[model samples]
Target: MIHQIRIDNFKSLVDFEIGLSRFSCLVGLNGAGKSTVLQALDFISQQMRGDIDSWLEQRQWEPRDLGSKLTAKQNVDISVQVETEKHGLIEWSASFNRQSLRCTTEEAFCDGVRLLKVEDAEFWIDRSVKQGSLRDVRSEIMFEYQGSILSQLKRKQIGEPLQALKEVLANIRSLDLLSPEHLRQRTRDSAGHLGLGGQKLSAYLHEQGSEVRQRLLEKLQHAYPQLASIDTRSLRSGWKHLDIAEQFSGKVLSTPARHVNDGLLRLLAVLSQLASDEHFLLFDEIENGINPELVEFLVDALVESEHQVMVTTHSPVILNYLEDEVAKQGVIYLYKNAKGATQSIRLFEIPSLAEKLQFMGPGEAFIDTQLTELATEIQSLSAKGGKDVSAAKR
Candidate 1:
């Protein structure tokens, strides 16, 4: 599991560190750096997958090089610390240059000593010219040219370490970015190992036999009593479909996996991922497209799983479902500071209120209490001549 992440000069993150828990929720308004955190994790995992170049390309690095452009002074420096049950401690750092539009230096450390550094020309050094200039210097450097530590360990026949890393990566899956169209295609294909968008749900289900399928059905039924049975079938045209029978009605209803509601599909995706042997899971916007009534069930299911789950949500409904113990375990609140930089504070760090009032519901209480407090602070500052004047006078 990732114990902490420290980001410097990465997009909006100038310098920030966040500690994690087994089941964590990151809540804040939009554009508050929530998605950036998920993307940062994705970048780390992609680097381990030997796809750092491709990942950098997605960020629009012109020269398509990482080692040549990423530097501590020129670009952003990112340091991540992950704690594992088997391997102990692993740390990774990379420098990204916004001006040069590339990553120049990349390094990985195990238990604090440098294990890998890929800035040499042999790993990556390409020639490229400016728009009208004829000169060319080392344009890009491939950080994972020798493959990731995880991949190298696997190739070396280190089964335990590879398994441990794989479990950690699997748990970092980000499903919220999945698109409806992508989900439809996956349902149509019935592929296994459902990707972020659940495009592989059908395939995964199709690969399973009656026993495993029945087990999944049972698990789903246990979480959702309304679901009588869940089954998968392949058509002659090579399309796969999921059949969901409602408990109240005996009639069996079928929907092309694509036709399923977003909420239902999202819930299934979460459950399927949690059911895997992964040790940690991080979810952004956990409440997106999910029903309020099912939030509690979803939380319960997550709690039952052996893997640690971290979810980011703005919904009090979802927060309410979390047990007090779990809530106190690792809850983080993301807020923008006076300088417009994003920072995180532990939810428990906030003082309990006096004259507590009974809330109609968790959602209501969250808005009336937590959110209201922040809003009131903002209002008070605005009334006192806003941020600019206040700062100038001080």
Candidate 2:
């Protein structure tokens, strides 16, 4: 799982570091760069799959677009250090040159030992030439930066650091489930792991065995008592469509997936993703269309899941619904200063606010502690700066 992340020269993040918990929620006022952070993670997740040049081209991003506009930085650098249970820190960086909009540097390391490091077209791997250390095993790995040099490691017989880094990369997944419309689409594509918008839900859920399907359905039904079961319908073209047994209008109805309410479908999408094998899940606007009352259920599911969930939410009720222990430990507040730079601090680190949470919900505690003033203050010397933010025990 991703233990901590350091982001610099990316979007509105400027230069900031964020720590992660098993499950976390990014709660803050608008324009705090919450969604931008999620976008950056998604970009890296896709880039890790290879074809970095093609990935940037697909989004029509210029060199200037990737770096922080808030500063005149020479490069765009994103580095993540994932901590494994037994092994030590594993790091990755696909740094880009701001002028050329090209990846000038890419590297990965395990326990401070270099696994792969690329500069332009040149790279070094673990020693295989029977000459020197792994860092001395140099090779040419550039295809005009179209993909990662790590892909080459996969093809060759690599060991340790590279294999460990590969597993870490595989665990990173970003989910964008805001589109209820996509979930309702008629798709022929394999319902592999629940895709970005859950568009492939029908295909994926249909392919699961009866036991797995029943287990997930039971969990979903627990949160939404109205739901009886989820099953697939055979369409004329030999394709299957998702349908759910729901008790509505005083009668049980087998509703087509497309016809179901957006809230139900969105929750269903989240459920499928949580049930999958992915370890790291990044979600933007996690409370989009769900009923407010069920917010706790969503929070509960995420916090209890085996996966490490990172999500952004505009809903204070979502934060308020969290239990004291979960709220104090799992919430990370994102705030924007007058100049529009984003900063983050976990609630557990703030003693004053943490104490207030024992008596009030997160929403009330936020207001009472003068955080609102700090966010909008033009020259706040107290509890406003990125790393120096403080509260004098209201």
Candidate 3:
């Protein structure tokens, strides 16, 4: 599970850092860098998966597009801290050259001991005696590697700590901006994971066991009383499709994927993600196409999920459903500073909001406040020695 992230020179996130909980909700206005945070995480996941060039090509982004325009830095840095059962707390960082779109340096540290380091195209793997022991450099120099050094190494060569770190990074799944049209398409029979846009949901649903399918049905029924059942069918062309059955007045109605409502399809995508095998999940605008009454179910399911999840939303109803304890730690507010750099602070850390939280729910306070105006007030109060601004600045 990722406990924290540090992104430097990536879009508007210059020297930015945010701590994460098992479940987090990122709330902010549009263009406030909420989506950019997910993009940064996605970029790191892509780098760890192998070829960075293919990811760039898929997005039609230039190598220089990775860096922020606010800084003249030639390199972009992305780092994450993950807590693993076997390795404890492991911190991994990768530096990429903006012009080449390749990893220039990468390093890992577990509980303060350096386990892996790669610099100047020369890499070293430490086969230390124990988990927190001193670094033992098993050095090697490779000049012709692409993407990340960790991705290029064989599992046989790396120690347990490095192997665990790679696995955690490679397993990140971003389900951002899911489209209903994409979700309705038939996919190959071998598709096991929901495609980033939920395009392969039919094939992935076909592979689930009966227990998991039953759990999904229960979840859907709670929000959608008409939903009777959901199943998959095979196409003659070796593709798979989804069929949903809804009951009304004791009459069963069968519908194909192409005919399902937008809300139902989006809800299915959201619930199916909670049952996925990915260790970390990123969801953007989760409230989109979901009814206000069902927002509670979505928030509750996400909180109870075992996987580490990060969600972004502009809906006040979503915030209203969070429990007080969870809202205190898991709710993050993102805003752009006067310099146009993205800044993040926990929701409770804001002096203006903290005062109101005592008297109201997060959603009530959020709906009643204007963030940019509150930012200006905080700045004025800081100048007058009224409150410590540093707490909210970070």
Ranking by lDDT: 3, 2, 1
CA RMSD per model (angstroms)? 9.3, 4.2, 2.6
lDDT of 2 by residue, 81-200 (tens): 777765567788877665554556887777566666678577777632222465556777635433345544563546555566656665566665458887887666553665666767
TM-score of each: 0.72, 0.84, 0.92
The whole-model lDDT of each prediction reads 0.57, 0.70, 0.81
Descending-TM-score candidate ranking: 3, 2, 1
| Counted clashes in each candidate structure | 14, 3, 0
Candidate 1 global CA lDDT score: 0.57
Off by over 4 Å in 2: 53-64, 97-102, 127-132, 142-147, 155-157, 233-240, 247-252, 348-352, 367-371, 376-394
Following a full C-alpha superposition, what root-mean-square deviation does model 3 have from the true structure? 2.6
Better of 1 and 2 by TM-score: 2
Per-residue alpha-carbon lDDT of candidate 1 for residues 1-394, written as tens digits (9 for 90 to 100): 7777776655455566777776777776777667666666665555455545454564555422232112244555666666777668766566554544333566555554444444643222111111222122223343334224343334333234334544565356555465556555634453345665566776666666667767766777765677756667777777776655665566655656567778777776677777665566667787777777777878788776777776778787876776655665555666665555556655544443112213233344455665436534543555675442111111
Q: Model 1: residues >4 Å from true position, as ranges? A: 52-74, 96-114, 117-171, 179-181, 186-192, 234-239, 247-249, 352-365, 370-394
Model 2: residue 324 alpha-carbon error in angstroms: 3.2
lDDT of 2 at 239: 70
Give me the candidate number with maximum TM-score.
3
